[model samples]
Target: MTKSDTITWIRLSAVRLPLPVPVSDAKVLTGRQRPMTEVALLFADIATAEGHRGIGLTYSKRAGGPGQFAHARELAPALLGEDPSDIGRIWTKLVWAGASVGRSGLATQAVAAYDIALWDLKARRAGLPLAKLLGAHRDSVRCYNTSGGFLHAPVGELVENASAAVARGIGGVKIKVGHPDPREDLRRLTAVRERLGDGVPLMVDANQQWDRPTARRMGRALEEFGLVWIEEPLDAYDAAGHAELAAALDTPVATGEMLASVAEHRELMRLGAADVLQPDAPRIGGITPFLQLAALADLDHLQLAPHFAMEIHLHLAAAYPAEPWVEHFDWLEPLFEERLSIEDGRMLVPGRPGLGITLSEQAHAWTTEVFEAGVAP
Candidate 1:
């Protein structure tokens, strides 16, 4: 690649969007009716001298927008004049540069923005879609709907949501559990199971609401429902507890969404903490480390189901040798110009160069702040 392909300028911005419907899980059961909002996104756009630009983003539930933007600003100088395709070198450099502060949380989230943009840039430069660029194992992957089944909704509403998702061709559905009364959780699960029947896959997320004993007791009780997996039955860092719960229950234990590094995931695997691994690209330092973690999961023969951001995870999931599940979330749909295509529970991977989507006019309008660095072309 020519010098024109080198990074010339970097732009960072924060976008705050109000959720059309506030979502509450078991962890936030008290705030059920309140209309919660999310900062939604912190975006990065890397412009190369060749004039091609790649866009990337990380998200926050309701905060961390300012911190992510500030970290990106601090990291941008290290990337200016560097080759956009040198993703590994750049990722390492950024990680070490911010090591004094920490390698996880906001810092890694910031690194994700740049690293994702670089992969997008590289894929676009090659004129291949990200999945194809990464050597896709398949062009489409199965999906499950998780947006509708929140703890705040009535039991009838939960059943309706899962039914509607199945009618729309989604193969699976998940609902929030972890109420103070385990019987209440069981009641909701029973209703959903009756509605969806035995054919449709059902899963539940506890959202780390239990200790080891509770997790073990509840996991065994819920086994009768034939759940696809029990997600976050305990705190994400509780490796020994997770392993114990996994061994004691018939249901597969799944976690890793909140984790921040490959080393953390390595520890989880080493401890046999989970039967299924759910890594998020942005949270684990973007696509580079995600690939590393996926490889590790493959060697261990664990199931792969990445956390959120289906638009990005769809491509990564398709790269997995075994069939993987991508989560369907419409929360960020307003920020993008194109919507993903789904049929019969599988989403089609975009074949266009890079991630194959552009930020919408609404995304620009929602921008709360912007930061820029590097020389103009």
Candidate 2:
């Protein structure tokens, strides 16, 4: 293809809409009510000579609301006329140029969509699978099922979910703990392990609900369950707390879901605060930054179990040696063109170029209002 055949203008637009997804027992560790909101993004290569297009999403029930639409609009002007082939340079420009507001959260997620689209477009141009382009790896990737279907479930119900996961061939499972009462949490852990038997690798996430003392107490009890790790036991911002917990606990203290910068992760590693790191692909800019973060984790002897977005995380984990958990949640299936393939408890890395997915026709219809509105940020 000639220079004229390449992408000439990138269009970044988004939609803020609610999906009709059922809550499958996922509850806030604090037992607080969940914020009801969902956000998704659509990026177009208006100038693509090959008719290549890609879509991405950033679903949040937290602080960043429909306000992400504003960030997406702000970035469109900057990327509208850039070459899709210049993915690395463009990604750097997007993240660094908006340091004041775009270094984290929705701003970073918006940039991530476009950056990931560029990679998809680039991969399409080269006729290569994303994993192959990223690194040489086995085509199939491992996965751990995170059946968050237990927000209000009794301890028995949670263990039932674990048994169901194992029955379906998954080898690992993640459970949410950190209820206000430490003893009750231990009771739940005991029931889950007893039901799942001794062989399954069980991981627990506190979702940043506990403080140092509470985390230490919970970690001590969890040690008996042989937990893979304890995730976000304390605040995500507390590096010293994590280091303290690591020192006090036998189960590895895991975090990094809320970290938005490479420097932040580097500091966490230097402090020896964690044994496993879980970064979200869309949350921390995009794959480019994720790879840099993964490299940092590898060098520091830390494991990279990314926070959900397992479809995307599968690619990253396949590229690296860190034993990762490809969080198995079905919330996005309503919007994806190709669903992730998991068998025998592992997620297979897609061989398609550029994130290997497109927006489902139904999802595009649902999101039409947000994109067509062209709402000002």
Candidate 3:
């Protein structure tokens, strides 16, 4: 006999995790954004009437953290008495509940937390890791370190960071490019490549700062390095521009991390805009929608390299059909009690059930606000 579990309670917390130092990329260098000093995280904890619990999270950089928290607070009650196993159904309902906000961007991001929580709940109930529950293709995924490659670091520091990450068992290193001075960008990459040698899986991210002409020139110039990919060479929305850029360069063009909806990613694919699709699980409305998008990307035979939040992406990447890359940023390590394993250039899928994570005392200490829904003592 089967007993349907009803989601009876939901708790949302807003956290501000401070970075050890200000972070900068081409977005900062180009004067489009300020250096980042902290990240705003929104966490969802869902409890079922049967005493089953699950956790999920989403985050924002520089701004919009509070907005996501607020949205989730308003959206939490909708889950009360609903089947926790009906992830796709609940996701659709949440999207329509905030229909005024449209189906993408902030709305999707907020709903993402709950949607992920449901999947986590489902996996925990089945006593399996999320990747295995999702039918993983591998037990581990290739990894690359991006935190040490921000634009603010000097060339010496960049080389040092790359060297350290490689030695630490990361499969590759991705440095920030798209400097105001193209020559300076070239100079930095030359030094990094010279130090890392040709065998390493090296990559560069423009962070959407390059125009077509600049991207074209840099793409041509970058050919000698044999990079695994060039990320966000143009604005993320410029599918046609990215398609042209992807065609012009032998190196695969990667983008879509900034996109907020399946439609946005579909447009990128319809035009063949990118060779590598870098969707973020939390950013695109959690693993529910991410799996939807992954199916589409796989159909195109495109490469996958989910952006940040390695904790969540490692499981998702492992489940991907094509070998995928998971970006590593240890900034969120303090939030969780469990740590991921990296060995021989890959991140192993944790065998623990669900997300295989529990919030740390530090997470509770950093929590700025809390909201509870449909649960009363």
Report the number of the highest-TM-score candidate: 3
Q: What tens digits encode model 3's per-residue C-alpha lDDT throughout 1-377?
A: 79887988899999999999999999998789999999999999999888899999999999999899999998887899999989999999998999898888888899999988888989999999999999999999999999999999988999999999999999999989999999998999999899999989999999999999999999999989999999999999999999999988899999999999988999999999999999998888999999999999999999999999988899899999999999999999999999999999999999999989999999999999999988742
For model 3, name the residue pairs that clash.
none
- In terms of lDDT, the best-performing candidate is 3
Better of 2 and 3 by lDDT: 3
lDDT of 2 by residue, 1-377 (tens): 66533454555445444635433222354445463445454443334544655444554554454566567666666665466677778888877767787487767876777766666666666777677778845676656676543445677678787888788776688877766677777788778788777888888877788878777777887788888888888878899999989988889888898887677787789899989888887778787788888888888877778777765677778777755666776666766789777777777777677578767776657664344222221
Please tell me which model should have the higher lDDT, number 1 or number 2: 1
Please list the C-alpha lDDT of all candidates, in the order they appear.
0.88, 0.70, 0.93
Which tens-of-lDDT digit does each residue in 218-276 have in candidate 1?
A: 98899888889999999899989999888888899999998999999999999999999
Q: Going through the candidates in order, what is the number of backbone clashes in each?
A: 1, 7, 0
Clashing pairs in 2: 24-149, 25-149, 25-150, 25-151, 27-151, 120-354, 143-346
